[model samples]
Target: MHTNTSTLAASAVDRLRQEIFDGQLPPGTRLAEAAEAKRLGVSRVPVREAFAALERDGLLEFTETGRTVVKQLTPQDFEELFAMRLLLEPAAARSAFPLSRKQQQLLSDNISATRKANSLNEVTRLDLDFHQLIVEASGNTRLLKLWRSLRTELELWLGYLHQQHRDRELDTRVDTAGSHEGILDCFQNRSAAACEKLTREHILSWREWLPMAELET
Candidate 1:
């Protein structure tokens, strides 16, 4: 019974987190426990528990008025998230080279899904997952765990980026997809150096478009 209750609380938390990340519950929106509990058909206890968990994950800020609001990712948050990815992803790509058949297939599938994604949020999720799959395929449990810990903040940053940008030209999407394909091809061909170089270039490309000062401020 206790375990089931805990699982329910976790489910509630994940659902709430997704809503916030997908912009259904925007930053600065208040989360009233009673309202959420009623909406989710869960008791207040679980709602409160979920709120506390989200707070710890840096997704929510609790106030003196006993209200919780979704937190916004500051510029430092974006910088740190990208910085960590820069450190981890290139290494993962290099490790992924000499790829096993399974890893190659996974990368191919991720690229296909990214192309097929109907919405911007879907594409963003696929992009994040593609990097994660590479890291996990490297067979480094510690790296995978650390990356998961960073995902909440990363998702928040991606959500902010998606919301702030409106232009979605086909050429831009094709360019992004081509970058992933380039790294995948390098991995498939067992070219570790090439894979690492492409991965670094892909990450650094963010600087070409993303506004550094606006995001930081």
Candidate 2:
């Protein structure tokens, strides 16, 4: 019974997190456990547990009225989170030299997968996987740990940017794989400076001009 409850809680967390990230449950939206429990056909226990987990991810917070709500993001929040990524990722790429054969294969797979990805979410996921491979290859335990800790927050921002990109009817035909080819080329050449510069540019290419209302909610 205990194991079943835990599984339910984990499922609840995934569903709620995806809803929030996909913009179905906007910021400032109320999170009522009873309502969620009824809607999801689960007990209140799992819903409550899910809330606690999302709260820790900076996605939910309590209002002064003591009600749980999706926490709003700001433009500064996006800038800060992305700026941190710029700083750490390049440094990791610089240090993650002499990639093992397996790591190289992983990166090669990500590159191939990116070209075939159909949706923004799929592209963003593969993009993260590519960057993570580079970071883990660095062999710096502390850097890898910090990067792992940022995964959830990173997913939210990446998903939001990709969604906005599609909403504007931007050129979806642009080759996402083309951007990373240079980085891969640099990696193959063992040029650390080239790899770091290419990686930074690749990340900045995805930067979006977020609307204030969207950021605030």
* Candidate 2 residue-wise lDDT, 46-113, digit = tens: 99999999988878887788899987766777777778788888889888776777878888888788
Best by the TM-score measure: 1
Off by over 4 Å in 1: 63-66, 169-172, 212-217
C-alpha RMSD for every candidate: 2.4, 2.5
Question: What's each prediction's clash count?
Answer: 0, 1
